[model samples]
Target: MEYADSKCNAYDTYASEAKLYPCLPPVVVPSAPELIRVEGSAQSYRLQKINEIQKEIATERDKHANLSKKYHRAVRIVAGVDNALVVSSMVLDATGIGVLSTIIAVAIATEGAAFG
Candidate 1:
């Protein structure tokens, strides 16, 4: 009974010491070459992503430029049509006035000849 009691006391002391000072497992560190390889892969992935973004940016810029050119061309065509319509209206007005004036002159000459 005394021997069993001593063994129990020793276990209790060990448990108390373990609680006060905990022992953590050893940390496994990676080798230098393994760390370098991992870093290189990460850098390559980032560069690839950057290149893809740049390509997207260039594509968008091309689309924008094309749209701008089309818009300018449409504006120029509309302006030309408007100018042509204005000129045609002026020509029609002049022709109508010329016809009316000739008829009036003929009527006045006939009236003077009949009176004389």
Candidate 2:
């Protein structure tokens, strides 16, 4: 009888504990995914602006490089033409024959025209 009473008492205790600690609805805390999504949106917006600024900087650099190259090329061309003219004049002074001078002058004129 005592054994049966003990078994019954154990079952009753378990049942009372289950009833006392009934399952409750979970607290409605914001999910980690929701918080992460909000942060991600803000970060993406900042990154996009940074990327746009970087692109603009790259374009400006390219334009500057192109202009520099063009300027250098123009300087080189002018220097070469000036040197050629000086050499031609020296040669003409050295060779004082009339026919040869005429031919050389004509050639120089044509070269000048082509280069200029």
Misplaced by over 4 Å in model 1 are 1-38
Per-candidate TM equals 0.56, 0.43
Question: Among these predicted structures, which one has the highest TM-score?
Answer: 1
Query: Model 2 over residues 5-108: C-alpha lDDT tens digits?
Result: 44333233454343432345578997565453458879999999999999999999999999999999999999999999999988887776777889999999
Q: Estimate candidate 1's alpha-carbon lDDT, on a 0 to 1 scale.
A: 0.81
Going through the candidates in the order shown, the clash numbers are 0, 0
Please give the lDDT score for candidate 2: 0.79
Tens digit per residue, CA lDDT, model 1, 60-83: 999999999999999999999999
What is candidate 1's TM-score against the reference?
0.56
lDDT of 1 at 65: 100
| CA-only RMSD, every prediction | 14.5, 20.1
